[model samples]
Target: MKAPRLHIPIHYLKGVGPRLAGDLEHLGIKTIDDLFAYYPYRYDEYELKDLAEVNDQEQTTIVGKIQSEPLLHYYGKKKSRLTVRILSGKYLIQVVLFNRPFLKRTLTLGSVVTVTGKWDRNRAMLTASEIHAGEPDPGSKWSPVYTACSGISVRKLRALVKQAFIQYPDCIKENLPAAFIERYRLTGKREAVRTIHFPEDQEQLRQARRRLVYEEFLLYELKLHAYKQLKRVSQNGVQMNIDRPAVQKFIEALPFALTAAQERVVNEILSDMGAAFSMNRLLQGDVGSGKTIVAAIALYAAAVSGYQGALMVPTEILAEQHADQLDGLFAPYGITTGLLTGSVRGKRRGTLLRGLAEGKINVLVGTHALIQPEVIFRKLGLVVTDEQHRFGVRQRGALRLKGKEPDILYMTATPIPRTLALSVFGDMDVSTIDQLPGGRKKIKTYWVQEKIIDRVIHFMRNELEQGRQAYVICPLIEESEQLDVQNAIDVYTHLSQALPEFKVALMHGRLTPEEKEAAMDAFKKKEVQVLVSTTVVEVGVNVPNASLMIIYDADRFGLSQLHQLRGRVGRGNVQSYCILLADAKSETSKEKMRLMAETTDGFKLSGYDLKLRGPGDFFGSKQSGLPNFRLADMIHDYRTLTVARDDASRLVKSHEFWHADCYAPLRETLAESGLTQTVHLD
Candidate 1:
């Protein structure tokens, strides 16, 4: 019997050892399958060209024979340069190689070599970036350039890949079915893998890439659909009785009316909850779009049915904020509300936990503490997580497991682009709140240069004199030598000195929880007239009286983030303003400022942000559950993604596909990949 070649440890390969395997692991390669599946980010062409046809400063490749002895020179410690003369056709071109003295041993007289680099025709020189000994086959000239790190080189990666192709010629088995392959006109899995690492021509490279990209996307969509399928079949959904009278009374008693969009989404959520299946929904809305009220209505419905509800946030301050807001909303209705956080200790924590277990707390709001094992729910029917991306899949699953298949509703103030929504939130239904509340004025936004600091300060002072609070946001908490931008501390000091009459406070992530709460609470009240902070105040910090927002180094932030910071103001009926102080010199930076000044639509800005920064950086950093595609770009390959999604959805819904013999390959691949192993199928 042949051993499982695909699963063999990478170090067992001909040239790779334990140390080299560890380095390869950084590039997400650990086994023989992983090594074969590794694809290049780009390819470099080394097609031999006629020396006479190449122009100055052009990237040209030439094959020649050495005519002179290689001259080696050492200029400094640990630095050496090698220069040689090579004759190609009728031209004698000079080749310069820097810091590579060992190459002198290989470049003997009359030895043929191939060099590719910029050709300085006027100087009769070719500055070589790549050099090889006697390289030329008819159709194999394009070289793959793998992304490298500290311990690995592109050459070594190429060599290892070559060794794999030669030794394990028939190791990789096909993952896609023959019918599907024929329908899509895709290359076979083994051939595609080999071609991706070393393609004979451009057309073959394109075909290989398309095959792998489609496969990746199909598998990804299949995994997501499988999760959705489990939820659909669980049969643990709660049928809650929405308290129409109590919900109406609460809404009528509110100071403002709900926007049409919010009402539509509320009905959608209520409809999902009343169904036989559980509700896995994502509520998308801009800042101050009244998502809390919609969530409050759902919680109220759950409470009326004698089932408990929990609201989890990313920060303690936001938790407390939600608790306070919900307390006021639930007070008159006689529904109990409680807060549990990391700071709640001993007797308080014990009391909260007991209240949760005894069903005394109808709705509990807290941070990560809400997911801890100590807290138990009597009958959890609804789980709402605010700023959903801040928590990972496991965190959300942990909260869901606190109950028996509780309905989940994720709330985000950040508007997710449609492409991301299809992939990241593919398993959940989405509801978007596009309209802001009535009586809210569009915040006046301005883009000013650093030279007009005095004028901007004078304008802010006027707003301060009118008893309105202001927030000054910087990108960093402390000065960074690498980035020349304003820090929170420096801004706080400067503001304190400039406006001595007003109370100024500083807040950042480095501060303790207690200290951060104190600063935020002071600013929330009218006690602190000016708040200086970093992006810590971006989410869940709402102050109606604070009408002025000045973000320093606005160019450093993504458009969506800048919109969120701008949202900190404009909560009240008063005329608010967002002053973007950035020396935006580049066209892209200037366009960002212009767009911020032109419109206040969060969705529009988010779409642009997704385009400007790819999916990986769109969330500022890689969110835990976001898919890592090797060759498929969420933006560029959207058509392929859509087709894959459609195919996956169709197949997942078909019962025959799950049990048929033809799909055994797909089933085996899905099982062995372990992508859905952690899904909460139970």
Candidate 2:
């Protein structure tokens, strides 16, 4: 079947014009195809009802005749109001409009008009900004609302959407197979597209959403699988047949023994590193679960085998922490370590670069500075990245090219669920460290209401009296001019004055780099008894002496982020405690906070976090490059995604599309869909 052609200009299509087309460009829409694909974030229906059926606080569309002429009244300097009276029976209903004096001229006595708005019972009035002269048809019950700007109305945008759908092609290309659609009980692509914008009823809208969600997940999984196959066939890895003696020596030198899970993961990584093909592996673990120790072992092994190793972290503080920790770990084996970051400059950086190029620096740890052009390695055999999600695919590729397809080990403290990992990272081998080292204490947690603020402060004071440090975390750095929320600066000032005997330091994202480094240095040296800041210290600021963490407005943060913040403490042998303070407004927020108070398991918290917040905020919106889908609800559409993934896998395996005649259109779709850039498919 031939596809239909669609052509429509911006000006002639309903309410849009040259001016509005520029506004639409902000949303990435330029043509009829783009307009049809712009889905609604949500839907709300106004049930049509008679004047007598309109109840208080219910949104309804009522048709009635004006019993009296509309009156205009001016209040203060620039305020004006319009009032109209409508009679259904003996009862006269008043409709009020504020700041719209022009509405009085539009309504005349005995004129029939349809009004849509909420009715208020206390004032016994119908307040509406939407009033039309003629009664709308009762059969046109469902109203399609679109997002609007200042000059554009929802009704106007809806008209434009209708015209675009009419101009859409007659036979849209089917991206999924017919059998797959039957198995999932999904609607056809062409029909779904039309119904999504102008659905006949609620049922049709639901079906359209299901079909689109399935298509999205199916295409995503297909591209991921194809990339995995290509990588496996193209790359080669170094074969190192060294025994496990180096790894064992490093483990024995540690003050504590490794957990069984950690030991198993270490062995798995070693096996991959010794293979003929290069290793593209991910080491995922919960926060403070001892994944870094395993990574250190792998680095030591590479160094002892006369090869260089590099560990790249996301932040300067994390890079420094890793350099310090590894320096102590490899001291006994006579292995030297060096640090690289934006802070290092002049002769020091040059000396570090010389050591690295001359093979004297066996192990190097730093941030993205390691990927700079001036930095060269003698024979880099292994590259390990901390918090791999923080870096982009292109950045990682650039780092990988520094050596001969060096074995890549990516680490992330964010505990992604097993099912999601299988779909998102299908191209990489996964190793999990699910255990903590011996002698480490689990941090105790508690959820307190705002009413107990005084008591929480009293506890913090007692901890400070014992010569211990604490952290006071706020959600915002500065008080927003519009919102009345607690900020870091205000909290810091109040704490400093309240506890004059103890020193307090403040830090936030708005601070200069030098100021931030100074604050961190002071906290590390024990010069500050209390550190007030944002989540900037979540990932890699290790101060074992600080034993208390009090998060203000904890309900505003996600579970994974809260877990990462709590991980800042509990690094040493001392027992730590965390306090979560919420305003007790939402039951959902209370339940999420209670879950955090019950356990210290990062993976369990992460799973529950996904169920509560979904995938959008799991790794944060910036880290995870998945575009926000309007029709696909990750929580409600999990089953559809599962079915779609299975169907796509089966079709790819059974059909000879890669080498057959019916594959040309599929190839074109893949290129035009932007999957080529997303999954890096050629």
Name the candidate that leads on lDDT. Answer: 1
Tens digit per residue, CA lDDT, model 2, 578-674: 9998874788898889899998888888888988887766756555445456577555676776776666565455445454445444544555544
| Best candidate, TM-score | 1
Tell how far residue 74 is off in model 1, in angstroms.
5.6
Q: Give the C-alpha lDDT of model 2.
A: 0.79
Instruction: Give the range where candidate 1 is weakest over 10 consecutive residues by summed lDDT.
Output: 673-682
Question: How close is every model to the real structure, measured as TM-score?
Answer: 0.85, 0.79
Against the reference, the lDDT scores of all candidates come to 0.86, 0.79
